[model samples]
Target chain A: MYDTNYHRASSVEEAVKLRSSQDEARYLSGGMTLIATMKQRLAAPSDLVDLRHVASMKGISVEGRKVRIGAGTTHAEVASSSALKSVCPAICHLAGMIGDPHVRHMGTIGGSVANNDPAADYPSAVLALNATVVTDRREIVADDYFQGMFDTALEEGELITAITFEAPEKAGYAKFPNPASRYALTGVFVAKGASGVRVAVTGAGSNGVFRATDIEIALSASWSSDFVASVAVDAGQLMEDMHATPEYRANLVKVMAKRAVAMAG
Target chain B: MAKVTLTVNGRTMSGECDDRTLLVHFIRDKLGLTGTHVGCDTTQCGACVVHMDGKSVKSCSILAVQAAGSSVTTIEGIASQGELHPVQAAFNQHHGLQCGFCTPGMVMTAVDMINRHGGQLDEVTVRHELEGNICRCTGYHNIVKAVLSANEEMHGASRQAAE
Candidate 1:
């Protein structure tokens, strides 16, 4: 069962103060994953600093070619935002397809990225988009942000404030969801950005979200579904689970990459 | 223990709860509102669905203190006086339940969805949106039907009020 002291923060400073002062404290956003983990006795913090009242930590805005999303913005908000739907439909689709409505309504993109479950969908998109995560302390690129499964570059008391992604010329995500948890068995996000073509895969990788450099190279040469499909993905490093084998997840990565590329077109 | 004050339905309720207490537990244990049932300790099940500040949220996934100063609408608060809420009435009328363990959550979820989605209920959409809420009984056919009927009734009432 969950156990913790509760504190609400009216601002980011208050939240940081609570985090710095409290023992074994964890910041609570939508509480979709955090609360569930607590209920299963997986995590037991001494205090929960609720961030709902942190006014600056909500919203989604598109300025020029980049879409900036506040850390505390819910998945529902992301999925339903008209601007995002128009400009970044793939991200919006990923948000809408995550788990179910209640989970989407309660889960925040920042929280999901921070938690970085190997099976999560958002990490792949963030990596594909090459997003920059702005925290209370500093901004970190996606490559620098995610270190390993359930790991990030965030410091002890830092709080993610927003994420900014350069709007891709075209992007799409395809995933084979685990039936039970609705998390991806293997998910791929393919995007053609100003930097170049990028292909990121989640759920299949043993170390969590990683770029499929082979597939990216193929797609960058010619942004086509056929090229993505022809790219060979080595499955030796994937994680094995009850839902699928390492080989199965690795195979799915290529298939999903092809589908995502086709959908992007 | 921490003191939390919030509006339930239209009435304000205040209580002190331990830091570990979930918002669902506070409603069921302290306020004696048992309409919100706990199907699973995990947040995977949407059995403890409630509305917080006009949005549907899983109460099991929130701390009581987190809900301070917010407006919460539990399943118990859906009924007024002795009359059943429209969604509840639709569930009953359409036999949307079997053992009834999942009805309260189903009804509340439907109400929230219909309110937000303009009451344009269809099978695929209802099934898609109701993924969080699980019903082992009735194959969810009657439950979906009930939600659709309630949507019409609710939207019709709104139209009449506008007239």
Candidate 2:
């Protein structure tokens, strides 16, 4: 489906240049999503900018209490990284649980977050962690980055370089995956940061992943499962689908939230 | 078409192909390695799993051109000099395959898991790690068994080699 001429970018600058020059140029990370979309005739780009060889686009580093993951880092790399596992086991666990072993090996954090599929696992984790996404042009907080489902604040030719997330005191992510698609039916990431407790829910909401303000407020005060149960999320903000109704999602948000809180403890 | 070079199995090969051609197609069609199968048009199926630069990946979801300058190990590349790779031997001994369509992909994925996790194979980890490769046959009972067996064999080999 991709009839485009391929350009193997040896550096980030070349990739950005190639992306900026073409109207339909796309950055190819692991190609887990882009290649499949191309095979299905869903996306046909005019130029494919290969980012795998860009030397500076891979690694894991810890600066202060934050973990910085390069955009080109694969799910498998993150899942198995000693540094990430030692500091943030929750993130490693979530990375290992994405799709499967093969997908984890090939799929990348940048691609997953960039695609921002409602069912994806990373957005909620990044959102709850209050991560900062460093792009070619600017740095955007997770809250301001994700505009909606499959939408981001990225401008044309913008490419995410790295994502840095503050280490949480205690954090957990629980996802009820769609049996067939392996996408999230309702996923919740609960984190106890230095500021306060943050709760982000994905898959059940039409706006993709978003902070559960009521639950966050309650949890921030008490940081307990019982407190989380008392705060109800309105069903109006939930997404309805063949797998689950909006009311069911509303109910799941409460249950998953409680489970996440219990897990975080 | 682009002149692409990569090491497959242990040998380096160079080929010319369209930039959009998928690695699975190149391996199956151009190279005539049919052990890798395409079960789904989408990236969902791990049936086309292979090792790219020592990590298992869904070959169907990666372009041939992207694989240029990287090392690739397909199902055909795993077994060397007529000796079956440990994962393949385990699959054979355990009767891990039913229709055998997903065997290559399953073996490729199993080897990768063993490489990462070593010999500590639990039912949960095996099931979770095998999420990418789907087997409609054997109910996945033997597939998990094969991975465990491969893990044991590799661990034994490592110990023996170290001794």
Candidate 3:
């Protein structure tokens, strides 16, 4: 909580300029995470360029197999969007499951993905559905976008305008959330498309959200709950905390994956 | 310092505060509306729940500057004139409060829930929707009954008005 300046950015380019020109500027979306961090003095930026006012970054559009969601669209909007629900109910369900109603009303998908928290819900969706992160600069595939927990391929001052992805044939998300905060303790998102199956695990990875290759391969071959349940996720690289052990998290990954498959079916 | 102007309980109020001032502080300290409590500033507790632009949000988690030009409603605004809102009346009838620390927030959250769900909420939906608002004293037994009764009251009132 330092003395900081707040600038309302009207457009994406203006937001970029506002952030890039400042000595230490942060882009503010929903401010669900950033504001909390700043309040805790964990982050002290000289300026915050508010992107919520930017009209271009607010919507959910679906066309054919393609679904493009504006980064600033709040989780509540996504959860309640009828157009998005018709095309991708799993996404709506995931959005609905994030935090509580108040948090969902304020938190945005763009903010969730940009922060790249290890336990965030959207990263698992983006990674599992093979979505693309569309920034003001360029498009980055979901696979290449996330690097590690709290890490992403986004360069400094870059603004994420929107995220685009082809709707999977079938997808479902399941998570064992931390009871107090409602953040994913261990979550699994499963998607089946023409390209086969993709499984992404979040909240358990020490390196952040990662693809469960074994689960993906098993589901690709069988596309059955039993197959996914039988697939073992390696606990070696998982994060161990007061909430769960590495081994327990690995088990959660498998169980969640199986549940996700069943739910998708 | 940041100068923010927001409509609180239908009053357009202006205030000056630090850029880091939370909306809860702005509403309570700056505007002098003490109904919104700050139980946990970490956003875990829903004690600071308020409606910003017709949507329920955690006032403690949002900055006053961020809420510039927005319309906010706190627990102080819940009662119209002197009459208690349907939810408030139901809370009283069902004995929904014990310590009353979380009442303001729970009432606000309940109003928002009824706003979205049309007051036809069942027990399961009420419990699920009440996930954000925690009541330590009531054991949630009376609180759930209050919400259901409030929903019924609201539904009957609306239905009667229509007729």
Deviation (Å) of A258 in candidate 3: 0.6
Prediction-by-prediction clash tally:
0, 0, 0
lDDT of 2 by residue, B5-122 (tens): 8888888887778988888888888888898899985877789998999988888888888888789998888777899998999999999999999888899989888987766778
Can you tell me which runs of candidate 2 are displaced by over 4 Å?
A: B160-163
Model 2, chain B only, scores a TM-score of: 0.94
lDDT of 1 by residue, B40-143 (tens): 86776688999988888888888888888899998888888999999999999999999998877888889889987885777889888888898887899999
Residue pairs that clash (backbone atoms under 3 angstroms), model 2: none
Kindly report the interface RMSD of candidate 2, rounded to 1 decimal: 1.2
Better-scoring candidate (DockQ), 1 or 3: 3
Among the numbered candidates, top lDDT falls to: 3
Candidate 1 backbone collisions, by pair: none
All candidates in order of DockQ, best leading? 3, 2, 1
Classify candidate 3 by CAPRI docking class. high
lDDT of 3 at A195: 59
lDDT of each: 0.88, 0.86, 0.92
Better of 1 and 3 by lDDT: 3
Q: Fnat for model 3? A: 0.90
